[model samples]
Target: MIYLDANATTAASEEVRRAVLAAMQDGFGNPSSVHIRGTNARQTITNARDEVCLLIRGALPEGVTLTSGGTEANNIVLRGIPEAIIVTTSVEHPSVLRPAEAAAEHRVVPVLVDGRADPQAIAEALPASGDVIVSVQWANSETGVIQPVEDIVTTVRSRRPDVFVHIDAAQAIGRIPVHMDGIDALTFSGHKLHAPQGTGALVLGDPEETRLKAQILGGGQEGGRRSGTQNVPGAVGLGVAFRERAKAFDEATGALRAMRDAFEAAVLSAVPGMRVNGGSSPRVPNTSNILFPGIDAMALVALLDQRDIACSVGAACSSGRPEPSHVLLAMGLSEDDAYSSVRFSFSVMNTMDEALSAADIIAETVGKMR
Candidate 1:
């Protein structure tokens, strides 16, 4: 099958799988234990932390707190500081949007039709006084449109330097260039980068200065940020994934972009009136969210799956709900248009031949459906 659902999750690389196996066999002891086996497990986690920090470019290794996944990491930031006024965009993933909505005080900044949050709007959303945290997604999951993270940081800092900036980089980490120089807290997932599932991290700029508090309390693990017996194998697997991707970043970026562009060109040329959802925006190279004017996205997804090709309508977490995509709706798409959109996300594992074939199949299928 040709898997075009990288945004949902990526297949773990062979190296990562092997590393996980070795970790499970040789590093089975609890990270908190004091024995030799335990020291090895602790060192495994430490090495993963270093790799993760290196991948993000200038992230604090001491501030890296491994979590179950992006959802948990996001919750730690959104819910950790309840008293701080939460400022976030409407186009963020449900993980960020849901918790931010639950905050006692929050400001949901609107996005443009291109699916980008306005830096000025975000800056204006900040209060004149009191603590605040402005959270934004580095890249959108469905459309792959990249937010102006540096612009937001600069604008927010101009108004309030004390206002913390957090980024949910689940879709951006391995796929694009992400700098942690200005970001206060950045979260990324392992499964998104060909690592084992149930692995992720929250990298803080300054763990001491951030108002982030621990949501999960236990034996004071993760420096009291997230307390639990760490997943040693998963961390090792994630480290391998990060290190391998970092080495091949340039090649992977070009390959994924080429595949996505080729696929979109073929499909759009063949299918009259077909349009890319965020075509005009600055997006990550691996994603294409297309609008098939008058088709049911779920039905199309099923048809593609039947043909041994995989894609999706929206975020995996919100699939099967029979609702239009919130990301599309926030970008001013009508409910019908939102329901008619499908996301085709690529990975380095995909081939140009597969992209062309998928485009042909999609064009023919859409014609038959119409």
Candidate 2:
């Protein structure tokens, strides 16, 4: 099968799998226990924490805490922050968007047609007078467009020194450069990299400066910020994944971009009216969302799946729902245009040869529809 849905989930690397297996077999003791095996499990989580912090570049090891995945990390930040106004973008993942909507007072800033959140809009959305949490995705999941995180954080700081900033970097970490210098909190998932699905982390800037009360009250774990028995196996896998991803990072990203760009060029050349969503924005190297106007996207997906070429219509969590994409609608696309869009995401493991072959298959399949 030619899998093109890396944005949904990536296959765990063999090394990560082995690490997880070893952790499950030998590091099974509860990290909270005071025994040799327990100490080893705690050490494993600490190593993973350090790896995650290193990946974010300037994030503190004291600030990184393991979570179930990006969704939990996002929830912990949004729900745990001091009661204040919540501000987020219209095109954020539902994890960020939904929690912001449930806030006592909140603002949803609109995005440009390229699906990038405007720093100016977010700055303007800042509450008149009070502590606030400004949350934005470091990069969009559906369109793969990078957000102006540094600009937004600067804007928020200018508004209020105490105002907090959170970035959901589920798709950005391990795939691109992510600096945690000004970010108050950031979220990333293991499955987006070459690790298993059950692992993720939330990297903090300064816990004392931006205090977070735990929402998950249980046996004190994760420095008492997050509580539960840590998933040692998943943590081990995540540590291995990040450590491995950092090696030859530039080469991996560049090659992925080359293949993605080539596939996009091929698709645009061979298919009529093929407009790429967020085509003008600075996107991550490995994702492309294409619009096959005047054709049903689900039909194209079905055709692609028949030949074992897997892609996606939009976010994995929102699959099986026939509604138009919220991200596209936020970017001013018509419902018809939004419904007709399909996303092709790649990973380092996907070969350029298969990419070109997939392009040929996509063009041939889409041509028949047209």
Q: What is the TM-score of each predicted model, taking all chains together? A: 0.97, 0.97
Between which residue pairs do clashes occur in model 2?
none
| Runs of candidate 1 exceeding 4 Å displacement | 315-320
What is candidate 1's CA lDDT for residue 232?
Answer: 95
Give lDDT per model, in order: 0.92, 0.88
Output the TM-score of candidate 1.
0.97
- Per-residue lDDT of model 1, residues 1-370, tens digit only: 9999999999999999999999888789999999999898899999999999767887877989999999999999988877988999998988898898888898999999999999999999999999898999999999999998989999999999988889999999988888887888999899999999999999998867547878999999999999999999999999999999999999999999999999999999999999999899999999999999999999999999999999999644435467888899999999999989999999989999999999999999999999
What number of clashing residue pairs does each candidate have, in the order they appear? 0, 0
Residue 182 error, candidate 2, Å = 1.2
Query: Tens digits of per-residue lDDT for model 2 on 1-370?
Result: 8899999999999999899898888789888889998888888888988887667888888888899999999988888765778999899899898888887888889998878877878988887887688889987888899998888888778877677888999999977899887888989889999999989988888855446778798888888888988898999999899999888789889999999999999999988679999999999999999999988998899999999899989543446568888999999999999889999999988999989999999999988887
Best-fitting candidate, scored by lDDT:
1
